[model samples]
Target chain A: MAGPSTYVPKSGFERWLDARLPVVRMMHGQFIEFPIPRNLNYMYTFGGILMIMLVSQIITGIVLVMHYTPHADMAFSSVEHIMRDVNYGWLLRYMHAVGASMFFIAVYLHIFRGLYYGSYKEPREVLWILGVVIFLLMMATAFMGYVLVWGQMSFWGATVITNFFSVFPIVGDTLVQWLWGGFAVDNPTLNRFFSLHYLLPFMIFGVVILHVWALHVTGQTNPTGVEVKQKSDTVPFTPYATVKDLFAMVLFLLLFSYFLFFLPNYLGHADNYIEADPLVTPTHIVPEWYFLPFYAILRAVPSALGGVLLMFGSIAVLFFLPWLDTSKVRSGAFRSIWFKAAFWLFAINAVWLGWLGSKPAEGWYVPAMQIGTIYYFAYFLIILPVLGLFETPKPLPNSITESVLKKNGGQIASGAGQPAGATSAPETKG
Target chain B: MAFFSSRSLKSLVIAAAVALVPAGSAFAAGDSKPPRMQDWSFAGVFGTYDRAQLQRGYQVFAENCSACHALSRIAFRNLMEPGGPEFSEAEVRAIAANYFVMDGPDSFGDMFEREARLSDRFPPPFPNQEAAVAAMGAYPPDFSLLAKARAPTRGFPGFVIDIFTQYQENGPDYIYSLLTGYDEEHVNPEGELGHYNPYFMAGEYIAMAPPLFDGMHVYQDGSPETIDQYARDVSAFMMWAAEPHLEQRKEMGFRVMAFLLIFGGLVYMTKRRVWSAVDH
Candidate 1:
């Protein structure tokens, strides 16, 4: 477990523990001495921010379940009881609810950073795939958790989304029934959703461990996207990445706390406050904002089966992204102007799709979504591969050190005699 | 030239595939305008509910709307809770004693009714949806969560901008609008059974008649009892009902934000100090 660490036991008890377990030595090696690319930017901090959000959600969720009742008859009233009677219950509930949204926000930024820098290229594909798996799990967990509130939106959202499985010819209806555990989504459905919602977060935690393992194996990708060539190009994870991550974590948490307390219901739909009434469906049925992009794609196609296929296809394409994007150059910085333009356009299209998804699927939105959906697929399947072959990229920097030195006029010494912890080092990690 | 020769046909094929997809032209059919925004006591990061206003609003609700709509989700104890109207425990007990609640079956296995307890939820005006519908010609929705249950959809740019503007008064705004939006000058075009209210989501016709009138409830606090005043205060109180912990939430937010800001500065300093070893 120690992996040939230089750590030596300093005490009799330490010596005995080190020989038997070596856990401390392993932690020291992995977290402390692990070499991270110095050129990593604030975007890299989202990984840490996301980790914090996940833990926050889990802790708050666990506390909420202690006060929560799973029965459909009691669930909505029980939630109200928790809010009104239990001590600090509102805080815990708001943290968990808002934490889900914040988690997605960080994940989206992390993913965008990966795409921009080609962090999924080469040896990091497995790591990226694990991340996608975690994302899917998060979505499942959030969807089920939303239903546990037993609100009108929760009931209808569950019904509409679960009905998507029924698009299959023979197994569809049976599959939907099995998923519901009944003829209709009822007490059984609520009970099962609560159970699954509680279970998936731990599964995500397990996958996260694997994600970190993969990341450690491949090392960190930097903004420059140049591979670490020498010891000078990397820095120890301790004090360097840790401090930067902490700074970003606090900043991110401030924004999260703002939503949690100040405008807690801003991101939420008003319909969710009403308890589930199967007979009375709201005029408009909308999913949570995070799912809106895929929701848009689901409505783009005229045929139900095609809509389901395309919706699943959108995510399925992501699994093949490493293969689809074949550029030798790693960073968007060096990539051709056309490639960068296309990347930004693709990003904008995704956001546009999300906006349109929230709109009713009729009139101009139908055509708009169709165009957005086509471009979304084409970006991955066509644009990436073709652009990789024909686009001319800019000249590469000799090294990260040289890139920094060139920007700084080469007159300044690169940590020649300066004592550490004196002042800020401008572009130290470049 | 070499690139074009190799990829031109493939690019053309892809382009054709993208463009050849048939377009459909069906538009969303609704003229529901975005609810007009209203200034609220609980609008900003630092905003807190006006307790006196909430108390008056609660009085209005108790005297008028409680006859038809129920507030089943709110327990009597919540009325006296912090961050709300903050009624005295004695007041809440007195209020609870006024209503009769169904109790459990006795040892003889017979159900009974008794005076409401402080912990009991507000009793429904109707025993069931069927009763409510039969009595009113429409099911009267419960008031327990109605404040949080109705808001106009702010499509696209409005929603995006709302994130930065912290614009979440839509629920209260819609409530206020519906309360005051009854148009006496114009008649319902369809001549529906329900009355006309332009602000109502279901076209011009609303099942509930205009519930608030001028001087509906006398506010002992010397606040105006005008219909408009009643509408605003009740909307504010409904917001408080929907989120009883809002004041405490905002207070905690400020403290947490301040702590995080200071902590962030310290982390930034630490980051700067730690990174000083390296030069660029």
Candidate 2:
């Protein structure tokens, strides 16, 4: 290890900057000197992409706060004023609105990437857990923010959600009252939602920091199912990972921009323009698109309480994922055929659930939801553990370097005496 | 090995500490009272207003609120009435042009713009009623019935309730109070009312804001620059927008009731003619 040496600065500004930050040195030591696997794919870029989205949300939200009115009556109209009255307000409003959908899109992909790569395994467990926390917070913040608009959908959505507590066994009504701060979802409810919505993003920011910290501790996992060994097996993170992440982020922005400019309200509901009316309910009330899957889960069960529990369980089960898989291998590349097939089945089941959620519950809808709901749980509990014990995995290379060489159709360098078969040994030790 | 172990321990401690602080605070807060609107101006913006602005207000409302709120009562044909304020036939067509309305057995849909024909009520977002309810947990209420059902009262109960609920004003007074009533220090000294919301009319907290910009719409010629003036104008627009046919509905209701009474007497007389042959 190198010891700190006395430094002589030639300029006053250099001394001042060094005294305050030492940012350059820290960046050099942490990123430039850090060793990372060379064979990482685009999937690894999601965390960085998520970070970009987080920053975008914070910036856009702050700008929106400048013009937004948090009162229930004015919220709907104020949003209108933003669209019609503010200079370029329409663009800002559309971007922020669409940006929210884009954020969720990125987060869903990030979470699925973790699942596919087994990025939550062993040392990376905490990182994945923090990511889950971030996910929960994001849901809460988004839901509350929706209520801040005070539109018909906003009002009815709040009423429906707060009323979900009424399904609880004994204290349900009390809980609902507690949530609403009144007999109905009215002014108090709106006020509180605004405050919490304003505060939660900061909490998300903190959790995100923890997420990145945890990632740094465990390091990133690569696609080849081989661990980093020698310095030659890896590359520095700065120019390599940074460039790739930036490229992915730019590509994502292009997609988001297209939606923001061309089809601003394409994903939105038309009824929201009417102000909130507690007495005369709109004929239909659908939640934001991102929540469709879980919304389907809520409707799957016949009983209200049962539906709520199942909906919550769908997300809560993610915390137990590390323990439930029971697989000796971490990466999907090395997983058995049965496990691979099960993963795809689970993905299809989730998509089916989202589709079912959007449809009216009638005839075949309920039964279909029930089946999708069962598969959703079965994938985590039964399939993972059973596949781990019975199925046989394919052979894996000794190190990341060897895996890449094999892919490139090149032999290992001569006289490097490290046995090609030694890869499974360290894994077994783990 | 020592370095790695100590560093890991440090990381664990840091993580534990980070998690603990928030958890502790959250528990201490113990379901901290949900945030209340603190300013009066914000409350006024959210409060329901007069019935006159229904037409022109609907246009502004449609441009902004439709994405999140649903008004089920009003139909496409309603916009064509002379009394309807927001859009002319050409404008309605232009506005509808952007959307595709599903029709016929082919499952093919065409874009709407211009005058809405008889079949052209606002298109339902979902396929049918069942789907909408399934997705949202409840049917979104229609706007046509909204003003009638939830219209503010003017008597003692209304006054007492308004006072207790921290509603500082009512009707036009309420609207005016809300738009201009923002103040951070307007909290009740006795702690009877909650936080003072600047946007609220009655000095109570509200979930809406006063939504007028300094110069949102330029009336055909030239309009003055003032946010307050715009707020009042929009509020007037909202009143009429909510109940476009209030006067007509009241007048028709009375006339129909009178016509029903006379029709009942005539039906009673006709009954004797049919029974004359059977009377023996």
Candidate 3:
């Protein structure tokens, strides 16, 4: 997709620096003067929102760890000390806690957008897989971070989730025992969890760099799923994408602050307030809302190993999604009714699975989970592969710009003013 | 025009159907009845704690509950802080002097007990968990975060709607319900040591005796001296203990939302101007 650089150094220092490192030039080519598909909807804003959330999470997380104690005996009271004693500790703690949920929310939206638009197809396969990598790391980071609170939910959740490893054949008990530093969830487990929790987000940040790099290489897929044919098909990333992302980020923050201030503890479990007691467990042991879907999958089958395999398979299926669909079409926009119906059903089924996951694994919920889990696998394994060959898609426009023109009554809208500096003539090779 | 095409229309119908279908089967565990959602003064966004109510709540705790339950996280000085009871420094000092706490090793190398200073935490009734459990035959939980720690489960749609309604009073509701729950005949256990409480989160029976009576204490401000009022007041106080900075948090939250909304408007206008030059 790279053609020619639009950035030129006006100053002598920039030129000198560009000659030595070209970091500025690289950034200029990749970000500032970078071209994106013009018709990207609000869904694309989540990438930027996620970036902001990551930075905020790092900052808030760094601050919380300063006041936090990793010891099992004192971790609970230490959190209390942060809430009551430290300056603006409540704000920092809530931002970190609520920020995790918001991060997951943005991620879910980002993933769904990819699914709905077929953003994972063809050349974007690497981009999609890298995203899955980030998602896996995020889950690990979030799980470790939750365990750091050292409360009833934290202790029991860690105990229950780590027990998931115990279903393995010969290595089962050994693996779980190694996961916990001792016989049970105690001080060593907490200390190690804190160490890794701090480490993984940075790793995620590293993977994010590669993810963004892969994205720029492939370029973006528009809602029409058409490739950029010329400069006119796209707009500059600076003012247009920047301003749009800024607006969406602010709106997202409005929701974030609603939880941060008025309903800070709403996303958190009540059992977390009580200090951890290994002797007794709460009646219900539930994971955070983000993990509910997988939790449901894990409990869907009657056998222990069956549930575990299904849970792992659920994520493994996403890695192969690029090949699974077998459809030449890149966007759901041009796809037939079967694709649309299947996609929406998959989405609603995933949400339904999450709801079912929160319920205790008993009674009608077990059957519902079993059914939901079956459909979940079917969408990836059967429906996507077969329907891709059978389904006939709507006729695609010749170009992204042509689709935009057709949408606007077959005429380009007004405004033929002078081009913004450096934005014109982006010269996309594709 | 593009968003409203056949694909979008299909999506709208499908999405509306999904929305109409309620989230799975609701999980109502056993025959446990849900607590009545109380209309707390500090329930919604604009809510703040009632100052007089907090003061009476503190008095109720001091007169009755303090013998077994310990407010270990709070200090006398906190009572004087803004957004709380906001008692005078003199009153706070008097309250601090009321309790004797274990202090530092003195010059004579001895841990001496003296009147608690403003910074000192309220002394616990028992030195350790074993002693407390031994004395009471069950643990007397500290009051620092009991309101938060005791929040009961809200299954399914109620929990889903709680985010919108800002329903964060489950703990206080449970506390009030448990306190007043002793009024019914079915509440008492067959044995002397334990009492049955359908509202008890862990089990159907509770270890502690009936702590509140009809006229537990006379309020200085002449508010209702009934058990319900005491239960409500103490529950509010416990909520404050669990989250002392709710007032400041909500107040700042409102300001942040306002700022984001205004900034959002300006950003939207800038976006419109930026996109105007680039036609399809």
Candidate 4:
């Protein structure tokens, strides 16, 4: 894929179009002939899964908009109408709703895969940063989408999350009013949310194009984390990665259908069934499952502003991940045991944070979130930077081909020209 | 952290699924206890709403609950739908005509009451929420989506299992609990007539007084008409009203899942064939 184009236009029209516009060439080079590390595992399939999810969300969302009422007064009934009256409308709504959750699942897997394999390091930093941007866009989109339902949770979730802005200084209240378009989360808020909820997915679609473009530039990282050294060490994107991704997608759809059909309302709050009423508020105002970890982080601090900052910081810190982790080694498999322990613990602590976030911020739950919050930050700011300075990474293979051969139990790989362990580099930045 | 725990693949899936288990929201508010899990006729992957039971449930709703509650979302025609109560067309027309729905101004600019059409929604007993509140000291919640609107907590590890076990009946379970919860032992009535059931999400008091009782409705189908039976029936009816497509959905879900599983198997085989020459 990195080499000169081997594409040959087949016919007269093809040649003419190829000369006028090189779209076919681009697709051919980017997809058909693209080189991916042969050792790529199930984790590597999530990028494709994410792309499909984005498309699924957009399609389902657009269909929903046709029947969905954006007005606060009618939105709740409109949803019920879709479920009850519209033909196959319930199926579409559930697909879109469950698709959102499934999209997050794929994205989380993709991000964690990147972290585990050090896909964020060096030349891939721009791709990683673009991903973080997409993540932000996704959160905003999901938040707005949830509010458009105009359920009790929708009303209060809009109220509570928007109220987070009021913790700022002199302009706090003003900023909130601007956000709400009124003194409270009312029709105007719902209107704007509906508009943006529709608009943001397209914006996400645009960023995803760039995301893929950037990914192609740096290429994909495999579980081995060794950069592509030769063509023999990798396989063509089609007939290999495509087949693998297709298989994974089918399995993913199976899981998704389970939720979409049998358990449509499982991911949703029951209160959402109740129409939005400004006069009434449910006792618990919890965001969707995706936001729980961040919500916990927000509540970890006693100070409201501090909590908000920390919550935002949890995501913002990810932007600096490439530089924060001083380790020269890529992939946890090759990193020292301490690094492995820290990384997995970091992952588990995050899950714990999500669990804690779901519970009310009372009793020991509050203190547990505080501790989890500290570790969440400590993993990025402290452990990552400090561990890289002292920990020794395991010896790396001479090339991707060599690693593949080693895994196959000492088969001699003629493609691996250089001897293993012959070329050694220091793990530390210094 | 077991970096490569025994059976790493399966464990990893469980760990991730556990992490994402329905966090934050219960059915509704931050109620202290989860509703008792019930074994519903329609509670699993293949579960379908029992047709006969749904009809009986509708009977309970029409007889006891209809005076205060409004199933405004339900049209008379909906009762004739295949998956629902499945009442005949003539029967549904008879049921519709039984109610006097507000009709339109004819040639003159005036409104009049007439027999409800099949298309007409079930009318509310009260003119509006304010009127209902004034009449009853608290506004009666609309029964249309009430079954979907209420869900008690299913705490910790138990809630996690609810996902696989397909326990999506929190709404019906909570409703049944509240209806039967009028037992004096667990009931907490405030002042003269203020009813407060511990099962209520709003904490202060269950604004609606206990509506169900023994022999609430004489069951013509020979089904028991005890307080428990009535509560269960009404709750089930409410669930049907809230999600009329439950049977169709579950049926459709099974077909889709089966197709995907078989297709996935083929794709897996193709993938294996495609990658046979490669050494990943």
Quote the positional error of residue B217 for candidate 1 in Å: 2.4
- Candidate 1 wrongly placed segments (more than 4 Å): A1-4, A411-430, B1-30, B189-191
Tens digits of per-residue lDDT, candidate 2, A109-172, equal 8887778878888877788888889999999998998888787778877777776676687887
Q: Write the per-residue lDDT of candidate 3 for residues A1-430, one digit (tens) a residue.
A: 6567867887999989888998988888787778898889898889999999999999999999899999988998898999998999999999999999999999999999999899999889999999999999999999999999999889878877777776688987788778987667778999999999999999999999999999999899889998888767787787678889999999999999998998888888888988898775565678899999998898887666788788989999999999998777889989999899999999999999999877777768878988999999999999989988988899998777777766765454422222343244434221
Give the per-residue lDDT of model 1 (tens digit) for A304-382: 7788889899988989999999898888889998988999999999999999877767668888999999999999999
Question: Which residue pairs come into collision in candidate 4?
Answer: none
- Identify the leading candidate in terms of TM-score: 3
Superposition error at A161 for model 2 (Å): 1.3
Candidates' lDDT values, in order? 0.81, 0.61, 0.84, 0.82
Measured on C-alpha atoms, candidate 1 has an lDDT of 0.81
> Which of the two candidates, 2 or 4, achieves a greater lDDT against the reference?
4
- Interface Cα RMSD, each model: 11.6, 34.0, 13.8, 13.9
Candidate 3 stretches with Cα past 4 Å from truth are A412-430, B1-30, B187-193
Candidate 4 segments whose C-alpha is farther than 4 A from its true place:
A413-430, B1-34, B105-107, B185-192
Q: Write the per-residue lDDT of candidate 4 for residues B1-280, one digit (tens) a residue.
A: 1243323422332222222233334533655455666778888877878778888888888887888888899999999998888989998898888898887787798899988999999998998999988998888889989888887766788678978888889899988888877546554434545565667776535667778777758888898878888888778888999989999999999999999999999999999876665556
Ranking by DockQ: 4, 1, 3, 2
Off by over 4 Å in 2: A1-23, A414-430, B1-280
Task: Please report the candidate that would top DockQ against the real structure.
Answer: 4
